[model samples]
Target chain A: MQDLGIRVLFMGNNFIRLLGGLWITVKISLISVGLSIVFGLLLGMIMTLKNPIVKCLTKIYLEFIRIMPQLVLLFLVYFGATKSFGLQLSGEVSAVIVFTMWGTAEMGDLVRGALISIPKHQYESGAALGLESRQIYRYIIVPQTLRRLLPLAINLATRMVKTTSLIVLIGVVEVLKVAQQIIEANRYTVPDSALWIYGCVFFLYFIVCWPVSRLAVRMEKKWEN
Target chain B: MEGQEKLLEIHHLHKDYGNGAVLKDVSLDIHKGEVLVLIGPSGCGKSTFLRCMNGLEQIQSGEIRLDGEVITDPKTKWSEVRQKIGMVFQSYELFPHMTVINNILLGPLKVQKKEKKEAEKEAEQLLERVGLLDKKDAYPRQLSGGQKQRVAIVRALIMKPEILLFDEVTAALDPEMVREVLDVMLELAKEGSTMVIVTHEMQFARAVADRIVFLDGGEVVEMAAPEQFFTQPETERAKRFLDTLSFE
Candidate 1:
């Protein structure tokens, strides 16, 4: 039996390399999720409008993004855009941009659902109370919409964090990329390096996502109360 | 009593609900401190007429004047018009997630931009009027149907509008829950708050309404004192309406 060196994880600065990769993954998700939320909220509001032009435009954007898989979007932005649009975009930048597009579409749909789920009488009640349109949204409509959306939004965030593993395909050097690097370095010396490193990679992703989903469930419970 | 000043005047109002006219040539005058109860069968335009006064529904061709200011004109801002007229609904439409005090405080605090301390203080008294002072910290879901309706009334009163419109408010309440909400309205009536109420409660209409307006088929068919209307109901449609509600 070939000696399975479990010691490669403890190899000088190797664990830190994995942590650095984890940090990169976290950074990409945060930046992408944050940008997606602001744009998604506006898009969501636009999608709810009765204006035909705005409704049609938002519908097109949402439908187009939703129909294309995120990985293909990443490929198009990373490789295809630089070739076709005469623009230069780094792998990490492309990853962030692609995730934002994907996340925004999902987020916007969630927000639209949340806003429409509210009874029509709610807006009428606010208007009848003499609230201006802005005040109606700020005080009544927005608050209720937010409460209905928070849990789903958080769940989307978790999905973003997990799906970020795909960024390794675009050469972003995220956690999975770092695991592959570790396995490649020990491939000849350690027989079980792939299994060990992949197991750790799986553990890292779980630790990142499980708490977020748990928080989502807990917040849903709180919203119900 | 006939010399009272007109508070809200709807003249030759018409409203279309995309397919056809819901309100046709409707006209009405609500006098200051007068409790006018609107009674009609479903789809008779009473609710549409009530909503038109509050600018919750747009009228096709007409003028609604509140304190002599034209509200139905194309240039009139709904927020400005609605500030003078408060409308409550059958569904209560209370902000379910908010505490009772906060729900009442929202209009005064956000719309009127009143101080929080002052709004909350007055809201407490208004809640007290509805006998829900103890439920100030409670959310709408925690309250009974009657309690929610009463809280909704308090929400409107805190705005201190010149006139209040009630759109079939008691129609959604349980038999036991209806009176508590009606009692709040009766108290407001005794206190001389000018109110336009769309209700099915004949006893409430007879006791509190200074005048009753019977609407049917998108038109006002009869307008008279509540006792006279309850006993007389000039039109055949109104007579049939009361015949159905005789048990109430």
Candidate 2:
């Protein structure tokens, strides 16, 4: 009888360890996405300001983020910052920081696009109705911007979740890292186990990300009119 | 119009967009309970002139007074002044997310800080006046163009403004829908609402206006009663403008 490699997952606590690793990935992504939304909204509004200095600064920031890759940003923060600044940041904290920086920039640009797409007459109507600038945003601009922004922002969240896979490179023992450890330990005993181990990792990622992608698509279709 | 007090005064108003003049040394006075119509060629600044009165556009050099208070001063709080002046745009510009009643009540409840119950009651009355009482809970997108414009008017009117400015309000409506919106304006005129109107609807202008101000090249060329202005314009430019309109 041929031995099936699927038994490798239940041999010890390998599956549980993979789940724990996934929790770390999710925790890092959750904190980073939450922070990005708050900061991104503020950054988005600032990007739309008419002031020359503010507009220039935000333009530079957006361009810099666009020009640099997220993987490089993670490396710079995790490896370079620790050496240059003599700081001790855990791999998880560093992952969160880099993802937040990337997420905020992407989310901020989405917000700016949404804000400017509203017709100029909307603001004029608010002013004509005697609304103060703050009240104009609260009553007219913010609500409309949110409607246009939520679906795009939700898509960014799913992308961030998938991108968290890169954190394993920075020494975070997340899912992929756990999968590698299990495969390495079983190389002699279960020589054919590599395929099953990787397949499980793929399934883990699918389970977490599929529903979120579906939600974003549903929201986009609902508001398409 | 002779004995009525001046509700709005414009003195030597100069406006430019940092280039050539859009409104050049223009001045006019609007009396209480009078309907003043401004007719002009496109880009002659009739809309810009109306926007200036509401402080929506900054003037290079000028003074505007409402009830004898200088409103064009940079130190002036335009929000407070705008509450006294209501404007309806060429496009209806109603908030799409809000229902008819909420749109009308926004200025009253948020800007005026009125009690919600009181504001809602006034909103209903204004909506009823515009024959949109049944659309109080309807969103802007669900209504016809004329219906939306009327709701825009109701939105402006709920502020209880001292004067109303209409900048080509019916220009975007269908030929059939135009009359319904104009009829509402005609009723407001009969009710003695102080109004400044810019329109291409010459017949409605003649019927609703106490006086007609003809403008060309950003300057007022002739100001006279509508009956005389329509029949016999004083300036060559004014006569030429009417000639072009008749061709249309």
Candidate 3:
């Protein structure tokens, strides 16, 4: 162990604070991702509508999010939006806002891809069965789309959790933020504290995201038949 | 024949895709219990004509009337009109997420607003009629191509529509699988279900069809009794088309 005394992992309340920071990370991701799913699903469905104007507007929004960087977006929301709009926004709220925008666009595109991939024959079958357009989507299209979207959606969730680390730049005090604070506090006593603390943060993210990845794989296997 | 009630009437129907026409000035009548088999070479618009009957494709001009009601006018709602017509496709298009029974029951339970028990009982009977009762719990992926087609037929039949449109339902099946689906259709014909089938199966048409309508280049080239059409086709194009089929 090189006798570097790695006790700081459990000492001076560092462990509990890391866990608290992790909880915040999970909470933000859960809320933002959940809301994004709802918004994305609606956006995706709207994008499929026959209206040209709606499609054009949604395309612009999707392109805007896809072309821009998340950090740039975060900076704009945190630094620019608050100052320009005279709104008092916290780092956590800004993070949520920025992540939701990105996640919703990605998820919306995933949903659109899944929806459009269903053969035209499927809709014809639904029509032949006397299904209304709404009923066709509810009873046929959306269910199939959901099955196709599951694996990608799970992957998106993990990406969201890891990407939540970006919030630290805006001072969200999440896991990575807490790690930085711990390392700076122990910079004199524990020379190698950065290594241990950052390592713990890495594993914390890995632990958070690993199960979701495994779930995606299991789902793909089960649905392949 | 003059006094027979017409279940569906197509009046000079015209349908067009963006680049060209698919059905042009076509007129036909389907009497109660009549079996009208449409045959033509590929791209002859037989399938498109069948689709227009059920409002899957909107006609550019003319009108379609079902049970004496105008069903092709812009005011007509396809969802309501379709309840009187059922269609089966070359690719079964069975809902992969649903079990066989659910696929059959979906129309009745959701569209017709039948109770679960009622729909399930009807689905099982349709399944039984097609010799697929044992596979009711199976998903579409678990079934053979023929089995999926059979379930698809049952899915349409469970609606008990007045007219059934079959668009080359056996074309995608293996040679061996085609017999089972054809047998089920033959059974339905024996039961006197009104049917419009677009197919290349000359033997089946000769056996079951009351009238054979030959279409070519989006036009109805000829209509005659199966014996008349098969033994003595009235049009040169149809004779050549049949000649091509026979060489295979």
Q: Compare the candidates by lDDT and give the number of the best one.
A: 2
- Chain A TM-score relative to the true structure, per candidate: 0.93, 0.93, 0.93
Contacts from the true interface found in each model, as a fraction, amount to 0.81, 0.74, 0.87
TM-score of each: 0.90, 0.91, 0.91
Write the number of the candidate with greater lDDT, choosing between 1 and 2: 2
| Candidate 2 residue B93 C-alpha distance from true site, Å | 1.3
Off by over 4 Å in 1: A1-6, A51-61, A79-89, B75-77, B244-248
- At residue B234, candidate 1 shows an lDDT of 78
Shift in Å, residue B127, candidate 1: 1.5
lDDT of 2 at A84: 100
| Candidate 2 accuracy as TM-score | 0.91
> Residues A39-134, candidate 1, lDDT per residue (tens digit)?
889888778899999888888988999899889999999999999997899999999999999999999999889989989998899888878888
* Fnat value of model 2: 0.74
Give the best candidate by DockQ. Answer: 3
lDDT of 3: 0.90
Q: What DockQ does model 2 achieve? A: 0.65
Q: Which ranking of candidates, highest lDDT first?
A: 2, 3, 1
The lDDT of model 2 is 0.92
